[model samples]
Target: MDDRPNPIDRNLLGIYLNDHLAGATLGVDRARTLADAESERDPALADAVRPIAEEIAEDRAELLKIMRRLEVPVRRYKIVAGRLAERAGRLKANGRLVSRSPLSPMLELELLRLGVEGKAAGWRTLRRLADADTRLDPGQLDNLLERAHRQLDTLEQLRLRQVSTTFQESGDRPVHQESHA
Candidate 1:
């Protein structure tokens, strides 16, 4: 009996992979930018994010490799749009006009977290295909999934820390008011 699964629709698979490639491009750019910007102000954060940024870049390469194995041609326009979108994200108001706002890191971290989560889902999707597709590596996808989980944890911790500092003065706590009749 044949063990190979039925072939997937190459056209649809190509489109899906290309869209993820665009997202990966934006994610790599944003991760590097966040790491560099945090270096001066938050060395610890820079240290934590730097590795994740490198990993994200590596993950992007891996995605490209997978696309090549699947014979999916990258859509250049999508890559360009991803680049432009990343730049445009910088224009959002962050409660500061000139200098970097404390809110900026918070927002960036949240975005990065969301991207990683999406990437994780992509990895899982490929892993599912790996069961019948010899070209897809389930073990590699598992490793990628684990790394994404770690990155999510780190980003969440950093984001929570930023929330405390950005929303409250050093020693201040939220005050409660009693209801009046």
Candidate 2:
């Protein structure tokens, strides 16, 4: 509505020229002035701004790629924690007597709280319990804790598998489907 290019618009064009010219051809000040003048005279002249915009967009894509690469391990950690919390909640509710494996309501609640807090050690303890073959005594809450931990580990593994597949697909195709058969 102002019919004038703002600092942000000038900055965007400046960034584009900087990238397209490899920072050698266009002076930032000159590009900014040009963008400002063009914007004031005719907003339609903004079409002349595309090359710079494209370059800036390419740079942004590269930065995002780097960010996601760094986030992979952190994402895995969150998924593991989330899974542990979910299993703990299930145990606390109706899963106590339903599971053949040991799972204590009290311990499950505690582990759930720990998982929500992002504690990896809590999930590890549950995993160890789940691996053991002996059936836990119904009276012992520790067994429930162990089973919950193990389930959490399994859930994390499953999440990783799904994520890996998604990464492999890379948005070129759909990753999930409803099975009618």
Candidate 3:
């Protein structure tokens, strides 16, 4: 039996980079679409969501830049897969025929919250690697981490408002129900 040192797993890094890149792309698309829908629904909400959409785009660009700096190739197939997944998400049986359901916004806000959480974890991982990889900057990662936290705060506020609006009592109780009064 011959024992030899194992080759470096270069594909692992490429896969990791591609996965995050795809995720960022998906996040950007979802953010833009949701921003447009919400803004159209209530013009006043535009003020709250417009900047978030812009920031998401900027973050996606940053991820691409990072991939470039690391010489990691962005997999086109992954981007396509991400787009398809986003499209499939809309097909879920939400009990609505054509019009948007009240639950849609709540589900979307939850997705955004989860995406932000994932982004924060990615930033933290990159920050850990910054000490070893000169291409990565700790400062930039720190800024991104902070921004993700702020994004979560904003998303949480929006989610809470949506929850209140979507699931609140309609004050139409059944005839069998006794009035507290």
Lowest summed lDDT window (length 10), candidate 2: 21-30
Error of 3 at 171 (Å): 7.5
lDDT per residue (tens digit) for residues 145-173 in model 2: 45435534543443343343334543563
Candidate 3 — number of clashing residue pairs?
0
- The regions of model 3 sitting more than 4 angstroms off are 1-9, 169-181
lDDT of 3 by residue, 16-135 (tens): 878887787777777776777666554444467678778877888888888788888889999999888777887888878896666877788788788888888888877876766778
Tell me the alpha-carbon RMSD of every candidate. 8.1, 29.8, 7.9
TM-score of 2: 0.22
The 10-residue segment with the lowest total lDDT in model 3: 170-179
Q: TM-score per candidate, in order?
A: 0.88, 0.22, 0.85
Error of 1 at 14 (Å): 0.8
Best by TM-score: 1
Per-residue lDDT of 139 in model 1: 86
Local accuracy by lDDT, each model: 0.87, 0.34, 0.77
The deviation in Å at residue 91 for candidate 2 is 26
TM-score of 1: 0.88
lDDT of 1 by residue, 1-181 (tens): 9877877888988888888889999999999999888777777778888898999999999999999998889999999998999999988888778877767778899999999999999998889888767898888899999999999998999898878766776358433333465
